[model samples]
Target: MVMAHNPKIQEALDARDALASAITRAGVQLPAMDVRTPWAADADEDEEREGDARYALVHLGVCSASVAVLLADVIVRGLTS
Candidate 1:
């Protein structure tokens, strides 16, 4: 089979891997644990900057988890059919 090299997909995969490493270090799952970003804040430029940084990194975990859930649902439906 031929494989396509997509930069965004590769980046997302790399990010997921990094998050996995961080989660392993933190000793918590992305779903069950409240993973706080280092730059989280309530408001203002500083807060926005921090929140943006955190969200950027953490969003990968969220997207990966979402995809996993979707795939699991598809598998369940396929099995039940």
Candidate 2:
């Protein structure tokens, strides 16, 4: 069965997907990228926790130094162009 995400979590998931898509299109792949719901284990799955604690974090996991440089280059090009 699929559980509905709290609004904040849903938003975080959406952002994570969008970011992953954009970066992939830019020729970079972040294999470990995902929405990290640290609070999921501590709270009821369906309940919306209040305030800042409600939001999930987007974890951009580690990559190789070469990949890091490539990511940096992509960012720089994005900003400068």
Candidate 3:
């Protein structure tokens, strides 16, 4: 089944890509980063549509403790500088 084009999903994908690029430049990696599909998890792929449902979320996923500290430091430096 071919699903209709969903701009919302595309937006989420674009955001994920942009964020991943930015994080790479930041010298960190989020191995599990992706778009959250809880809202459409139970639906068929072709049935995934944006209606009155909530928009998909960009999952930042997890990182190691040291990576977390590094991210925090990067954020802090960005904020202060």
Candidate 4:
């Protein structure tokens, strides 16, 4: 059975890719990720579990975005100095 693609997963992937690109352009490297969460793949499972997973992923994404912004700021400062 073919399952429909999950938008949340795509959004998360896009965010990660964008952040990686930004970091690369800034000549900064992020440490390799040690944890992996199957965000979309587990969507069809239990409702409570899926909700909790989604919440956690969203929180992680937010934290990543903040770090990306901080990196950009540091890069800007370095270039200006």
The whole-model lDDT of each prediction reads 0.45, 0.74, 0.71, 0.51
Name the lDDT of candidate 3: 0.71
Which candidate number maximizes TM-score?
A: 2
How well does candidate 1 score on lDDT at residue 67?
A: 55
TM-score for every candidate vs. truth? 0.33, 0.75, 0.72, 0.45
lDDT of 1 by residue, 1-81 (tens): 111133433454466667667545544445432233334344456545422432322253343666566555655766799
Tell me how far the alpha carbon of residue 37 in candidate 3 is from the true structure, in angstroms, after superposition: 2.4
lDDT by residue for model 3 over 1-81, one digit each (tens)? 111245565677789999889878988888888776545677766666554223566889888999888888888888999
Predicted structure with the largest lDDT when compared to the true one: 2
Higher-ranked by TM-score: 1 or 4: 4
CA displacement after TM-score superposition, residue 42 of candidate 3 (Å): 8.2
Give the distance in Å from residue 51's predicted Cα in candidate 2 to where it truly belongs.
14
Alpha-carbon shift of residue 66 in model 1 (angstroms): 19
What's the CA error at residue 75 for candidate 2, in Å?
A: 0.5
How do the residues 1-81 of candidate 4 rate in per-residue lDDT, one tens digit apiece? Answer: 111144554455566667667767876656542223455565666643422334222223233666667777878898999
**Superposition TM-score, candidate 2 onto the true structure:** 0.75
The C-alpha stretches of model 2 lying farther than 4 A from their native spots are 1-4, 39-53
The candidate with the higher TM-score, 1 or 2, is 2
Which residue runs does candidate 4 get wrong by more than 4 Å?
A: 1-4, 33-45, 48-81
